[model samples]
Target: GDDSFDEGSVSESESESEGGQAEEEKEEAEEALKEKEKPKEEEKEKPKDAAGLECKPRPLHKTCSLFMRNIAPNISRAEIISVSGDIGLRGRVGVNPRSFRFFRRGWVTFDRSVNIKEICWNLQNIRLRECELSPGVNRDLTRRVRNINGITQHKQIVRNDIKLAAKLIHTLDDRTQLWASEPGTPPVPTSLPSQNPILKNITDYLIEEVSAEEEELLGSSGGPPPEEPPKEGNPAEINVERDEKLIKVLDKLLLYLRIVHSLDYYNTCEYPNEDEMPNRCGIIHVRGPMPPNRISHGEVLEWQKTFEEKLTPLLSVRESLSEEEAQKMGRKDPEQEVEKFVTSNTQELGKDKWLCPLSGKKFKGPEFVRKHIFNKHAEKIEEVKKEVAFFNNFLTDAKRPALPEIKPAQPPGPAQILPPGLTPGLPYPHQTPQGLMPYGQPRPPILGYGAGAVRPAVPTGGPPYPHAPYGAGRGNYDAFRGQGGYPGKPRNRMVRGDPRAIVEYRDLDAPDDVDFF
Candidate 1:
C-alpha cells in the first residue's frame, strides 16, 4: 500500500510539468505571428507621409532619367530647377557628388512615359549663369555615362536662327509700313503670323525687349549707346546695320513719292522685250533699250523735286550715323572723304589726254607728252636718256638679221686609190683627208701582212679611229706618206704671188664720203 501511493505522487508531478511546457511554446508562436502581421500593415501605409499626404516615388529606371556630367561644382539644386522650368521640364533632379575632388554630376528623372531624349535635347547646352549645362541621355539605360560639350556646334546654329528671325522681323516691319503708307496697295497676307507661333514669339520679343532696350540706350545718349558700338572684325553686324539704315532711307523715299507725288510702284518685268516698270521704291528698271511708253518728262521732274526734298534730310541723317560709326571705329571721315575726292578726280583726269605742265600743250598719247616734257623742258634728262636707249635697243633687236645656217662640208668622196696601211675590205674612213698621200706606196694588207702574204686576224673593232693625218684608220705609213715624208716634214707648195706681202696692199680705211646715218 505505501509503494502504490509514492508512484501516484511522482506521476502527478510529471503531468503538471509537461502541461506548463506546452503552454509556453504556444505563447511564443503567437508572438511570432503578430510580429509578421505588424510589418504587413506598415507596408500598406508606407506611401503616406507623417502628415498623411501622398508621396510620389522617384524613377528608378535609367530610361526615364538623363545623366548630366561635368556639372559645375557651385551649381545648386535650385538652379537646375529653374533651368528645367525654363525649358518646360517636369522632373525631379538629383546631383551625385564625384568620387574625388571634382565637379559634381547630376541626374534628372522624369515619369516613365515621358520622352527622355526630347527632354535631353531641349536641355542640351542650356546656360545657367556662367556655366553651361551639357545634357545627354544614354540609349542603353544601363550603359556607362559620359559628358558631352556640344555648345560650340550648336552656337552657330543658334546664331543663324537669331539672325534669320531678325531678318524676317525687319522684312515684316518694312512691308507693313509700306502697305500702311500706300492706301491703294493691298494689305500683306496674315498667314505667316498664325502659321508659326515660335516666329511670332520671336517677333514679339524683338519688338518689346530688344527694341525697347535699343531705344532706351539710344535715348540716354541721344544716339546709339557707346556700349553697343559695332564689333571689330564682325562684318556681318556692320552689313546688317548698314542694310537696316538703307531700308529706312528707302522707306522715307517711298513715302515721299507716294504721298507728295502720288506715284504708284510695281515689280518690274525681267523680260528684255517688256516695258520697264517702277519698283516698290518707285525707281524704274531700264534694261537694254528704253521702251516708247516711258514716264513723262513732267512726272520725272516732279519725282526729282520730291526726291531732293526728302532725300536731303535722309542723307543728313545717314551722314550723321556714318560719322558716329566712323568715330567709334577710330577712323577719320575727313581723311576718307579727301581720299575719295582725290581718287575720283584722279580717275577723271586719267581718262583725258595728257598735257605738258610746263608748256600747257596737250598730246593724245602719254609717250608723246612724256617726250615733249623731257625734250623741251629738259626735265629728267637721265630718265629720257634711258628711254631713248631702250627704244634703240628695241629697234636693234627687231632689225637683227637671222643667223646663217651652216651645212657641214660633204664628207670627202670615197678615196680614188686605197691609201697605204688602211684596213682592207672596209669602207673608206668617213673622215676627210687633210691632203693626198705620196705616190708609189702600195696600200697595205687588211691585217698588217706583207703584200701577197697570208693575212692575220683584223684588229678588234672599236670606235672609228680619230681623224688622223690621212683620215681615220690609216696606219702610220699612210699618215707619213700624206705628209710627204716622215712625221713633221710636210712638203710645201709654190704660190703665184709673194705670200708675205699678200695682205700689205689690202685697204682697211673707211671712205671719207660715207655717212653713218
Candidate 2:
C-alpha cells in the first residue's frame, strides 16, 4: 500500500510540473504573436488626412554651400561676407588662399532654411574689387588644389627669367662670331685696344675654359670681385665692367634654371595622383621634364611652349569633373557621342529614313533628320546635357541646387505717341486721304490730267475767277478763317466749286488731324 501511494504521488507531481510547462509555452506563444502584431498596429495608428492619405515624414532641407572663385588675392573676409549678404546669402563666408595667404577663391556656407538657388541666381557677375567672381564648382567633390600659389608665382618669375636668359644667350652666340671673321682670320676689333691684356684674358677664358667648366660654372653663383677705385676710362676698369656684365648674364641663366626646378616641383605637388584621385576638376596635367643645367635658347623656347600650354587651361579655369571623366573613359569623341545620342533618341527606319522621337515627324535622309532635330530639339538637348553634367559633377554626393537662368533684358520698342481719340489702326494725322473726298462736298469736273495738273487759282490780289462764285483767294481764305496761312507751306488758293479743294478744307477741321496748308 505504501509503494502504490508513493508511485501515485510521483505521477501527480510529474503531471503538475507538465501543467506549469504547458502554461509557460502558451504565454510565450502569445507574446510572440503580440510582437508580430506590433508593426501592424503601429501602421494602423499612423495619422491620415481627411482624404485617407497616410502622412509621410517631410524631406530634410539641404544646406546651401557655394564655391566662389577668381576672387581678388587681397580681398578681406569681411568684404566677402558683405558681398554674400548683398546677394541675400546670410551665412559664413571664407576665402581659401591660393598664394601666400592671398586668395583667388572662397566659399559661402548657409543654413538649410535659406534658399541657395535664389542667392546663386543673384550672385552672377558679382565682383570683389577688380576681380570678377567666377561661378562656384562642387567644393566638396573636387580635390583641393595644392601649392598653386607658389606654382603660379614661380611660373611668372621663370617666364621673365627665361626671356632675359634667351636674349643674353643670343648675345653670347653673336659674340662667338667676333672670335674669328673667316677661317684662320684675325679676331674682330672691339671698343678696347686690340692688344689689351684684359681682352686677351677674356678671350682665352671664354674660348678655352667654358666647355670644361660648363657644369661647375652653371652651378656656381660666384661673380667678379668688387670694382676698383678711381679708374674712369681706364682700359682695365672698362674690361672689369665688361666682365661683370657677362657674369650678370650668366647669373640670369642660373636664376632661370633654379626657378624652373622649383616650378617643376610645385607642379608635382599641385595635384594628386591620377590613379588615386581621378577627379581633377578638369585641370590639365602638365609636367615638363627637368631641364639641363646648361640650357640654351632652344630649351628656353621649349619651356615657354610648355608654360603657354599650361597657362591657357589655368586661365580658362578648371573644367567640370564630367569632362575629365569623359576624357578618361575615352568618351572624348564629341562627334561620336553626338551621333550616339541622336541614334538613341531618334528612330532609324532605314539607311536614310528616320523618324523624330519628339514630334513624330518622318525624314527622308539623315541630314534632314539632323536638321529637324536641331530645329525642334536643340534647346531640350542642351538642357538635358547641362542637367546631366551638373549631376555628374556630384559623383558621390547629392546634387546641389542650381541658379536660375538670367535672360538678357530686351530693349523697349520705340514708344508710339498717338494723339487722343486716335486708335493705332487709324491713319496718322499727316497722311493724306487716298481716292476719297469728304461728305457734303460737290464733285468737281475732271481735269483729264495726272496728279501734277494745275488749275486756274483764285487770284492772289485780283477779282475772283467766275468758276468760284465765292471768294476763294488766299487773302480772302485767310481772313475768313481768322488766322494766317498754316505754318509750313504756303496755301494754294482754289476755286470754291472744286470738290478736291472743298474736301481738303473740311478734312483739316476733322478731329485728330493736323492742318497743313
Candidate 3:
C-alpha cells in the first residue's frame, strides 16, 4: 500500500510541473509579439518637428550629401557658403561644415530638413560662374543635426535690419520729416515729382530716404547710381535743353541742301520719278523750298527745237565743204593719168602701124612710137596729161577709169627710147619713183650730180614741170611753193628759176620793168 501511495504523489507532482512549463512557454510568445508590435507603433507616430511643418521620418530625403562636380578649384569655403545662401537655402535648410572638396569635384551636405527634389531642381538651373553644376545624391542623412554658418549670419542680418527700422521710426515726426535738426536743416518734402520728364509717366517708387542718423549707412554703401537720363526721344520736338549754336548750324545746313540736290539731278535725262526713287535709287526726297525760275517742260522742248534749227545750217555747210575737199584731193595724179593713157591707148592706136597721137609722127613699130611720144612730143604729152587730169572729175563716179583694151608695149629689140646719155635699163628721170623720198623733204641728188649740187630744170609750159624736183629752183627750200607740194601747204604759184630779192614797196599798176613804185 505504501509503494502505491509514493508512486501516485510523484506522478501528481510531474503533471503539475508539466502544466507550469506549458504556461511559461505561452507567456514568452505573448511578450515577444508585444515587443515586435512596439517598433511598428513607433514608426506610425512620425515626429512633426523633423521636416519643418510637414511630418516626416528623421531622414527626410533619400540623400543630404551631394556629389558636386565642375566646381572651380580655386573656390573658397566662404564663397561656397555665399553661393548656398544665394540658392535661397538659408531660411529653409542648413549645410554641413566644411562641405567643399578640392579639384574639379566637391561635396555639399544639407540638413535633414532639405527637400532634395526641390534642391536638385534648382541646382539644374544654377551655374558656378559659367560652369554648370552636376549634383549627385550620395545617401540619406539619418542623423538630426544642424551645422551651418550661412543661416546664422542671415538671421543676424534680419535682426539688425529690424533694429534699424525701429530706430528710424523713433526719430520721425508727424510729417515724417526730421524734427530734431537745427534751424537750417532742409525740410523733407512729403512728395516730389521726378525731375525726368520721360519718367513722369513711370512710377518713382525709389525715394531718397536719407537722414542724419543714416549717414553712416549711406557712406558705406552709396546711394543707388544716378539714373542716366534717356538720350533718345521724338526728333520733331525739343524735350530737353536746346543749344542755340547747334540749332543755327542745322538751319544753315538745311539752306544748302537744295544745292546738293540740284547737282545730283543735273544732266541726267532719264531720272527716276518720285515713286521709284526710294526703292530703286535710295533717294527719298528733297527737303527744301522749291527752286525759283524752274523751266516748264514745254519751254525746254522749245529750246531744244531752236537749238536744232541753229545747228542745221552749220551741218549743211560742213557737208558741202567736205564734198569740195574730197573732190579736190580725189583728183588722179597727173603722171598716173599720163601713164595710164599711154599704156592703154597708145598700144591700141599704134598696133598695125605705130603712130604718135601727140606729135603726129609715124613709126615702123609701137616701140618707136612710144619713144617719139615720150621724147619729141614731151610738150604735147603735158597738154594731154592736163586733159586727163581735167577729165578725172567725170570719172569720179566710175569705180575704174574707162580703160581701152590693153596690148603689151612693143617687144624689145636693139633699140632704146631714153633721152641721150641714158641707158635702156636705167629708170626714167622724169618719173619720180614712188616711196623714194618722203614728202616736205628736198629731193636726193641725182645720180650724176654732187650731193649738194642743184640740178637745173626746164618746164614744159606748165606749173612745176612733173619731171623736175618739187620747188626745184626756188631760192629757199620751202616745201609749200610747188605743184608737187603736200596738200596741206600752199600750191597756188610755181617756184622756178634763181632766187629773187623781195621788192619792199610795189604798186599793183606798176610797169613790168620797174622794181618799185
Candidate 4:
C-alpha cells in the first residue's frame, strides 16, 4: 500500500509503505466484508432453501490484497522478528512481505494495530512454561521506559497492556513454571556479537534471578519474603521498584537485540572485522569482544550504504511514531494534549470566570447556572458593580418596602433663633474664593521684541550637539564643515553644498560678465 495516503491522516504522497499498507488493507477488507455481510439478497438465486440458508457473507479467514489499480498507498513495512517456544512465524525468514496476513503476493495491510509489538516482544524474550500465563510480554518493552537518574522512579504508563502476562510470570507467581516458554536454541552461523550482548545480559540476569530464588528457598541466610507491617517505605515495594529498573534494562536489551539483528556492520566492510563490529550497532564498551583488521575506505562506505538500506526501514519505525498511532495516541492522552499545546501552535487567549451554582462564588472552567441565596451574587470585578446597580433598580421598580434614607438635616432659620446654646461652625461656601493673582511666566521681551516676537538665532551654523543622534562632530574639519569623526577625515558637507548658503553674488558696479542683469 502507498503509505503516503492515510485513511484519516495527511495527504502526503508516498507516506505509508509496505507493512503500513497491510494494516490499511486490513481495515479496508474488514469494512468491505462487513458491508457485504448485509443480507438483503433476492430470494431467487437458489430456490430459497426451505428454511432460508443464512445468506450471511462468510468471513475469509485468509488475507487479501488491497493493492489499488495502479499501485498501493499508505503502507509502511512491518517488522519481522524471531520468537522462542511456539506460535510465532516459524522460519528463519524475516518479516514484512513474508508473514501470513502480509503474505499476499499483491496487497497487504500494514497497520500499527497489528500485534507485531507483542509478537516481537514474545519472540525476543520467551519463558516457555505449561501454566496458563503468557510470559513473553517483556519482549517489546525493552526500550520506552522511564529512567530517572537512571532510575525507574515512577510507574511507567502501560500501553497496549501486556500487564496480564507481566503479572502472571512475576517472580512471586506460583504458576510460572507451568507456562514458561523455553528460550529457544541459539541460531546457527555464529550468534552475531552485537545482537547477542543484550541476550547475554538477559541470560545472565535471568540466571541470577532464578539462582537467587532457589537460594532463598534453601539457604539459612535467605528465605521466603517475610510479611511485615507496611511502613513509610516497604521492602516489597522497593523490590518492585527494583523490578521496574530491571524491566527498563530488559527493554533496552530488547532494542539492542533488534538492532543487532536488523543491522549489518559497515565501517569494517562487507566481510566485517567480526572482532571489531560483529553487528551494525552495540552499546559502545558493553558490546562484546573485539578483533582488529584493516579495510579500504571505499569498502567501508559501500558497507554503510548496504547497511542503511536494510536499517532505514527498521530505524524509521523507531525514529518516528507511526503516523496513525501518533495522531490517535496524541488525541487520547493528556500528555499528548499538553505536548500539542507546548509544541504545536495552540495558544490560549485568556481565562474566563463564571459563578458557582452551589456556593454562588465565582469560578473558572466550564460555565454553570447562576445561583443566588445570599444578597450578593459572585461576579467578576466588572460585572459585580453592574449587578449591584441592577439589583437596586430592580427592587425599586418591584415596589418593595425599602430601608430609610440617611441624609443630613438642614440648618435652622433666623426666626427660630438658637434652639440650643451651641454655635455653628464655619458655614459652607457656594464657590471657591479667589487667591492672590496667579504669577505669569517671566517676560521674554528683554531677550527680543515682546510677548511672542523672539526669532531663532542667526546662522552661527554648526553641529547642534557634539554627541547628537546620527553624525555630529566638534571642531571644523574644513573651513565651514564640521569634523564628523568617521574613519578618515569626517564626512562633513562643505559650505558650498549647504542649501541655505548663497553660492554667488553680483554687484551693480561690477564688470559686464559679473554684473547683474
Q: Which has the higher lDDT value, candidate number 2 or candidate number 3?
A: 2
Best model per lDDT: 2
Q: What TM-score would candidate 3 get against the native?
A: 0.15
Q: In candidate 3, what are the lDDT values of residues 335-417, reduced to their tens digit?
A: 87777767654544444776666556667777776777778767867887778655664545332334566978886554334
lDDT of 1 at 354: 65
lDDT of 1 at 116: 73
Model 3: lowest-lDDT 10 consecutive positions = 261-270
Model 1 lDDT tens row, 1-517: 7799999988999999989999999999999999999999888877656535445553344335677776887888888878786766566777765334577777665656777778888887677767878877734423222222222122222233243333433343443354333577665565545232223444432321247867876798876566776656633321211124323333443343343333321111112211111111223311122223323335444544543443332222111234344345344333344334323322213556766655677767666765665467554445445555544443333222346569787754575335776655332555443333223222333322242453222233312233445433333444433422323222222222222312222223745333222
Q: What's the lDDT for all of these models?
A: 0.46, 0.49, 0.44, 0.32
Candidate 4: list runs displaced more than 4 Å: 1-195, 201-203, 207-227, 230-240, 260-517
User: Candidate 2, 135: how far from true, in Å?
Assistant: 16
Cα-based RMSD of candidate 1:
42.4
Q: Native-vs-model 2 lDDT? A: 0.49
lDDT of 2 by residue, 1-517 (tens): 9999999999999999999999999999999999999978887787666225434653444345777756776778788778787766655665555333344566677766777777776777777687776655334434333333222222323444344434333333343343335677765554433332223333322332335465466548575324435544533321201243444433444433223222122242233222121121323223233332333344445655665554333233233445556556443343455566777767788877788877888888767877888778888668657655544554422222345569797764556444576545333344322213333232222222222354333223222212332333333343323444444432333335453433344355555335434
Which candidate comes out best when scored by TM-score?
2
Q: lDDT of candidate 3?
A: 0.44
* Candidate 1 global TM-score: 0.17
Per-residue lDDT for 212-268 in model 4, tens only?
Answer: 755656566554445544545433232212245545654563343334332122221
